[model samples]
Target: MIKVAGMLLLLDFQLLPPTASSEAAKLDSLFFFLVALCGTVATLIIIFILYFVVKYRRRTPDQLALSGRSYRTLELAWTLIPFAIFLFIFYWGAKLYFNLMTPPEDAIEINMVGRQWMWKVQHPEGQREINTLHVPLGRPVKLAIASQDVIHSFFVPAFRIHLDVVPGRYRTIWFKATETGTFHLFCSQYCGTQHSGMKGDVVVMEPEEYARWLNSGSEGSAASEGQKLFRQLSCNTCHTGDSTARAPFLGGLYGKQVNLQGGDTLLADDNYIRQSIVDPEARIVAGYKPIMPTFKGQVDEEQIMLLISFIRSLKEGREQIPPVSDPAGPQPSPVGDAIRQSETNANAGNQPRTNANSTDQE
Candidate 1:
């Protein structure tokens, strides 16, 4: 029991506040106001109870009879005062919640995906990640998240923002990491057997460091070698063109309008596309089945970028030549005649010649 209590207490662990971003400041204000209001009310209630207990206590009296009486003024004051205090708290909390929910108009949008054990993140430039997230300071970052499997929660204690990631639904949560430092993340829900092991870090950096990180040939960069591997897997085969694929095409989809199956329209920008790839059922593409499988473990950030680039390159009238192993000529398929001929040559003279093999054995 003690161990469980300790774990619950550590769930929303918070460290010192970094610099004050807009969201962080608002959150701090809300927290402070709530703590003060509740503290004051609790103290007053305790004092009132103690005072009444002493004042009305029965004293030793041989011929006294006890009678109960109510003070009209005291009752009215207590009732009205507590009601007013609760109302104030409600109004204040609601205002802050509205501010947090309605993201700023100019906020930079990023797609966030949650799975059983990790987070799949995608940047506006098509970069992707598994368990790490990156964003620039002083800029509003919005996350559109969906779960690939069971229900999961996206929580960053430093930011004071959290939301549930449910399958077959789209949920949006935004936060601006004010200070440029690393913060811890938690699932916040009993997800699976590896729930405790499902942990990751959020790296917040300055604009310059973030930019350098993006261009520093790091493995998670949008244009790194992992993207090359992604292209090698040929994701464009079914995602683009009128290729009879079930899901929507990826051409010109980055900032274009998307029509979902349920008569709703959304921008087919970075966030939408990323979620669709990682959690296809979150928002179904119009006129298509949610048959697109999740690529959770098979793909990396760079590969996701390569896939995004390929998709982005498919904008109207832009035919992108896939960067596969080709030497200015047609590339044969793996099962084409060349492979078949090689296999036949390797077994050329190994077959038994009519009855000669039997006679030699005798």
Candidate 2:
């Protein structure tokens, strides 16, 4: 029992999981507020119901009751009061939702791929985890999650985060840990027969401890692997910076604004790049022809993310972090250099618009 201002409250462990993330405390306050509000309203309603049952009961067999007694002021008060409460809830929930959904600009991005029975996590530093996720304490970590099989929900009660890992697109969620500990990870959606077994642990550790752990078994960097895969898949053949190169140069193209065939312009984000690789024909560059074949069957979700990472490393000013091995870094190309130096106008005649060519496409 806990004693507050003249009141005693019972708190049991069953109320919620351990609050581990920064969002959890705020969410708990909101949850308890809602529960108290509803509980109070219900208690008052029950008291009123009981009082009316006795006071308005039939005392005599021939008793005549009052009819057509309209409480206009009472009606307005009740309706307006509940309306105001709902409005406050909506505003509070919306503000929190907005804050939670928008990941911080500097948050660490981790890629997650969900399958039938397990989760695949890849850190930017190239460490891979099967079902467990390791994050640094007090740092904002954003998860770029996708499903390879069916719909699944990435739920962590301690973190107050629950997001659907849907197929066909990436769903992102961000959380900053407040306490360093292991929390339960679950797929809250009913996916298949072994849905209950789709569980994991989220391990939060000190920043230095996490760095040591990450570097312990580091796979060569994700960008390096992606670069290797890019060559193995013959992507370098067309996406070169040579003067005679057919396709548009890929250097400094990650966050550039691109013009599509229908004059539609959008940032070259992960989804845009993913669509360009998988569909090829969905969104074409304004000045280029669609000749690149679809890589839908050639690459999986993880590979797509790797490719994105590789491309992201090509940002002109930002030197590549978590260095890519083998080639030392992304090589400079005449066309890519020209594209990088020039302005972002489609008709600039110097800016490389599409990663396309006369006969070969990609």
- TM-scores for all candidates: the values are 0.63, 0.82
Q: Per-residue lDDT of 31-141 in model 1, one digit per residue for the tens?
A: 888878788978999999999888877687663556879899999998999899788878987897888888865565556667778888766343566788888877777
Candidate maximizing lDDT: 2
lDDT over C-alpha atoms for residue 140 of model 1: 75
Scored against the true structure, residue 204 in model 2 reaches a CA lDDT of: 94
- Best prediction by TM-score: 2
Off by over 4 Å in 1: 1-21, 61-81, 124-130, 218-250, 253-315, 318-362
lDDT of 2 by residue, 1-362 (tens): 23552252343326458999888888888889999999999999999999989999998999888787889999999999999999999988888898889987667778999989898998765678988999988988899998998999999888999999989998999999988999899999989999999999999998778867765756555655676677767776666654455565666777789888888898988888888888989988776778888999899999988887677655442232222333444432111212121321221232133421111110
